[model samples]
Every structure is written in C-alpha cells, then in structure tokens.
Target: MILGEFWRGLKSGIVELLSALIAAGLLFALGDSAILATITLSSFSSELKSESVLEVFLIDEITQDGIDSAKTYISSLSGVSNMTVKDPEAAMDEMSAILGSDMTDVLGFNPLPFSLEVRFEPGSCDADYLNRISSGIALRDEVMEVQYASEWLDNLEKLTRTTYIITGILLALVIISSLFIFVSLHRHISTRRRDIVRNLRLLGIPPQSLIVISMMRAIFVGIIAGAAGVGITILLWKLCCNYVVTIPFLTTGFTVLAIAAPVLLALISLLISAGRSQSNLFASGS
Candidate 1:
C-alpha cells in the first residue's frame, strides 16, 4: 500500500520531479568540482615545494677548509635533506654551457663564486624556515650570498590557501542552496496533493505512514539525481584530464559522500516540512 501511494505521487508530479532532479544534480556537480579543484591544487603545490632547492653562494676567496666547515655546519641543521657544493670552476662551466660561451675567456678570469645547492625535506620548505636559515648562513665569514625561489614559494602557498578558502565557501553555499531546493520541492508536491492527503487522513490512515511515503519519494529522487550529478562530474573531469593538465578524480570515500549527501538532504527537508503540517496535511482543513 505504501509503495502504491509512493508511485502514484511520483507519476502525478512528473514535471516537478524532473525539475527537482535537474536542480539537485547541478548542485551536486558544482560541489564535486569545488572538491576536485581543492585536491588538485594542494597536490600540485606539494609537488613543487618538495622539489624546491635553496642555493647558497660562497665567498670567492674562501679556502677549502672554510668550504668543508660550511658544509659540516649546514648538514647538521635540521630538515637539511641533501647538499651539493659547486666549486667556482664548476659553476663557470655550467654558466658557460647555458650561455653557449665561456665568460671566463671573454673577461680573462673565472669570476663565478662557489655555491652549495641545498634541498630540504618535505615539510620544512616554508618561507619562514628557509629565511631564517639564509640569514644564519649569510652571517658566516665564508658565505657570499644565500638565495632561493623564496618569492615563488610564497606565492604558491598563498595561491593554494586561497583556493582552499574559495572552495570552502562554494561548498557551504551549495549545501545551503540544496536545502532550500529540497524544502521548496516538498512544499510544492504537498500543496498539489493536499486533497488526497486529507482524504487519506479522514479514512483513518496514520499521518506517520503518509510522511514515510513522502520521504520514500524524496529518497527516490535523491538517488537518481545524485547519480546523474556524479556522472556529469566524471564526464567533465575526463575532458579536463584529456585536454588540460591531468588530475586524479574523486576518491572512493568522497564519491560515496557525493551520492549520499543529496539523499540525506532530501530526507531532512521532508522531516522539517512534515513537522509543520500538523496532524492534518491541509492548512485550513486541519
């Protein structure tokens, strides 16, 4: 009997049902896209940070003993993953290869200073820590200069943080909009079926059963619409990966939540609307 009534309600409001489905699907898709962007940006930023290296230049006149001392000091510092010392001649050679000619020959001197190419561990590449290390290294007698892509790293971190904040706001708005949509859909359907609901109540049908049937209809719509949204998001993600840069899609846990969230929202709306309907579904006839 419950299933019969549920099907009847669905068929009677085909137009409204389709509208709700489309709206809900779009909301879900928007939410999914926000999540994907947050994940991809975070991953990209981490990769860049891990690969970043700090360059420390030595004074031209520093002896080999001073070079060994500097290397020992830097190696003992926390978060120093690895270090490679480039002698003046080696640095000149590298610069010569890049410029297609040796500046040493043109100037009658190899003026490039010795330097250390330093790479840090995963979590210690932030601006503040690197800046502190650079300051300390610069004060050493053998050190000429300390430099790294500090500005670039700072910008990348800011960009990742901004992406996260925007994504969070977008998701919160999506959830709020979804709730409003579900509430409106419930009211619209209930208003249209008022007469049938009143007659059912008069015939000794329990209000709880009526509410349950309505909730069942909501669940049905939620599942179908949620699946549609997931499909759309997947299609978009695939297109992005093919034409644009590649990024991994939603994980299993997030995919499940994307489908379940709409259903949960629908059920919540029905419960709220049912609470306000009193014992009888009609406003005047109750």
Candidate 2:
C-alpha cells in the first residue's frame, strides 16, 4: 500500500521534479564556476608574486667587500625569499645584450653599478613592507637605490580583490534564488495534494505520518535531481578541464559539495513545507 502511494506521488509530481532538477543543476554549475574562478585567481596571484623582483643598486664608490656584506645582511632579513648579486660587469653585459651592442665600446666606459636582485615569498609583496625593506637597505652607505614595480603589484591586488567580491555576490544571489524556487514548488505540490491529504487525515492517519510520506516523496525527487545535476556539472567540468587550469586539491572537495548541496537544500525546503501544511490542517480542524 505504501509503495503504491509512493509511486502515485512520484508520477503526479514528475513535472515539479524536473523543474527542481534543472534549477538545482544551474545553481550547482554557477557555484562550481565561482569556486574554480577563486582557485584560478589564487594561482595567478602566486605566479605574479613569484615573478616579483626588487632591484637594489649599490653606490659606485662601494667596494666588493661592501657588496658582499650587503648581500649577506639582506639575505638574512625576514620575508626575503632569495637574493642574487649582479656585479657591475654582469649588469653592463645584460644591458649590452639588450641593446645588441656593448655600450662600453661606444662610450669608452660602463656606467652600470653592481645590483642585488631580491625576490620575496608569496603574500609578502605589499607596498608598505617593500617600502620598509627599501628604507632599511638605503640606510647602508653602500646602497644607492631600491626599485620595484610597485604600481603593477598594487593594480593586480586590486583586480583580484574585485573579482572575489563579484564572485561572492553572484554566488549568494544564486543560492537565494534556488532556495526560493524549491520552496515555491514544494508549496504548489502541497496544494495539489490537499484533498488527498484531508481524506487521509479523516481516515485516522496521523498528520505526522502524512508529513513523513510527503517528505519521503520529496527525498526521492531530491536524490534524482541531485544526481542529475551533479552529473551534468561533472561533465561540463571535465570538458573544460583541458582548456583551463584548476587546483587539484579543491576540485574533488568542491565537486562533492556540489553534489550534496542541492539534495540537502531540497530536503530542507520540503520539511519546511510539510510542517507549514500540518499546522494549517490542524488550525482548520480546530
């Protein structure tokens, strides 16, 4: 008898089931995209940080000993990842390579000074920190200047921050909209089964039992919809994986969440709908 009722309910609500599936699928896709975007941004940020290098030039009057001492001191500083000292001759050679000719041959002298290329670890490439480091380095009598592309770093930071803010906003909106759709559809189903529910109540079937049946039907719908949605999302992700780079650690976790979120949301909405319907039924009886 229970099986018969379950089948009947499933057939009656097939349209609602399909609607919920499509809506949940879309929400899951958007959520997955947002997560991937965040991971991509972090990867890009790390790449930028790795490429960041600060050039510290030494005063021409400084000796080799001064340069060696300065290199040792800077290498020991906190937040300094790596440091390489380029002698005046090496600097001139690099410049000559770029210009396709030796400047010393044309001008009779190499004007370039010895410099240290300093690279910082990820998350330490900020303006204030760089400024502080530069100030400390300038205090040394052998140091001439500390230069980096601070503007470019600042701009990248701003852009990544904006992308995160926008992604968060869109994700929130999609969740709210999905929940609304689920609740609205559940309420519609409840109204359609109102007469049958009233007859069941009159037959001495407990309201709790009736609500359980409704919840069971909702669960069946949720499971089918969740599976379908997750399958579609995984398919799309696999298709795009070759074209895009994503973090391996986060991919599995996010995929699991995407699969579970829709079913959980559907069950919760159904619970709310059933409870509300039971309350109304008792109120009308009283």
**Local distance difference test, per candidate?**
0.83, 0.75
Give the per-residue lDDT digits (tens) of candidate 1, residues 25-54. Answer: 888888888888788888778777778888
In TM-score terms, candidate 2 sits at 0.80
- Stretches off by above 4 angstroms in model 2 are 1-8, 122-132, 135-141, 201-250, 271-275
Off by over 4 Å in 1: 61-69, 72-79, 122-124, 127-129, 139-142, 203-208, 238-247, 278-285
Query: How high is the lDDT of residue 229 in model 1?
Result: 78
lDDT by residue for model 2 over 125-148, one digit each (tens)? 666577678889988889999888
Which pairs of residues clash in candidate 2, taking residues 3 or more apart in a chain or in different chains?
A: none
User: For each candidate, what TM-score against the reference?
Assistant: 0.82, 0.80
Clashes of each: 0, 0
Local error of candidate 1 at 107, Å?
A: 3.3
188 Cα displacement, candidate 1 (Å): 1.7
